[model samples]
Target: MKYLVMVQGTQADYEAMRGKASPGSPAWSEQEVQAMYAYMSAINDDLSETGEMIDGQGLAEPAHTRTVTLGDDGKAVITDGPYSETKELMAGYWLLECESLERVTEIADRITRCPQPEGAPNYPVVIRPVMEGAGDI
Candidate 1:
């Protein structure tokens, strides 16, 4: 089975990663950021070598995102505004082909152990199975 493994974060978390201090949040130092990169890179390298990882990428900050909604006239309405500071958003994801849901869940568990500044909030790593075809339904 293939899975979309996602990691979530709030705006406060993003700011902390960028070395900006948010009240009650610890800012990540340069070395801390580098360490995080190295840790995640090691995991990616292992997954790639194991033929499990299909693709992965980090998303831009939530502030740079736009929301689109259907208007009454059926037109696409685009809007960008402040989101709740505590609202968690998808920060990144890994597309993996695994033997089973358990295997993918294990991989996601490993990601939850990624290094972080001491006071950083922990969010759940979500895993969703990808349907191979209509037959999967």
Candidate 2:
């Protein structure tokens, strides 16, 4: 089965990208940042060797995003980012072809342990099965 593993992050995490302190939180040290990059690289390498990873990538900050909706009159309405209303933003995602849901869950669990600042809470990873078309519809 194919599954999507989505990693979420808060606004604080996004601010860290620009070398800015997350409000009251301290900035991430150089060592800490390097450690996280190394950890993610190791995981991706392992997945590639195992032939489980189909595709995966981290996303840019939500400040670069735009929200579009349809108005009652059928015009497109657009709003700028910050996405402040949302508690969590999708930070990254991994698409994997795995044996079962259990395997995917295991992968996600490992991802939660990736390096981060001390005292940071474990963020949630949303896993969903990819539906394949059967050619009926």
Candidate 3:
């Protein structure tokens, strides 16, 4: 079966880290950023080599989000999106072709232990299994 592990983070928590400093200031120091990038990159490479990486990427800040609504009349309405409104925003995701839910959970556990860069705030990465249908193949 194929599964998607959704990485989620709370808006308040995200803001706490995202709004840490001046516009030009780096959220994390150079060394911290490098550690973080290296850690995540290693995971990405491993997944790719194992054929478990369907797609994955970090998103830009929520400030650029936009919302759209539609009515029964089929007319469309657009509005600004408050990306932080939800309890958690999906930060990143990975698609895995695994043998069972247990296997997926094992992978999720490994992902959960992703090291935080030195001096960086700790964040939880939420994991969810993708829904499957009869047509799934």
Residue pairs clashing, model 3: none
lDDT, ranked from best to worst:
1, 2, 3
Each prediction's TM-score against the native?
0.93, 0.89, 0.70
Candidate 2, TM-score vs. the true structure? 0.89
Q: Rate the local accuracy (lDDT) of all candidates.
A: 0.89, 0.83, 0.64
Query: Model 3: per-residue lDDT, tens digit, 59-114?
Result: 64455556688978899877764543454566677777777888778777777777
The residue-level lDDT of candidate 1 at 106 comes to 88
Question: All candidates: CA RMSD in angstroms?
Answer: 1.4, 2.3, 4.4
- Candidate 3, lDDT over the whole model: 0.64
Alpha carbon lDDT of residue 39, candidate 1? Answer: 89
Who is ahead in lDDT, 1 or 3?
1
Q: State the displacement of the C-alpha of residue 22, model 1, in Å, after optimal TM-score superposition.
A: 1.3
Q: What is the lDDT of candidate 2?
A: 0.83
Residue pairs in candidate 2 whose N, alpha carbon or C atoms collide under 3 angstroms: none
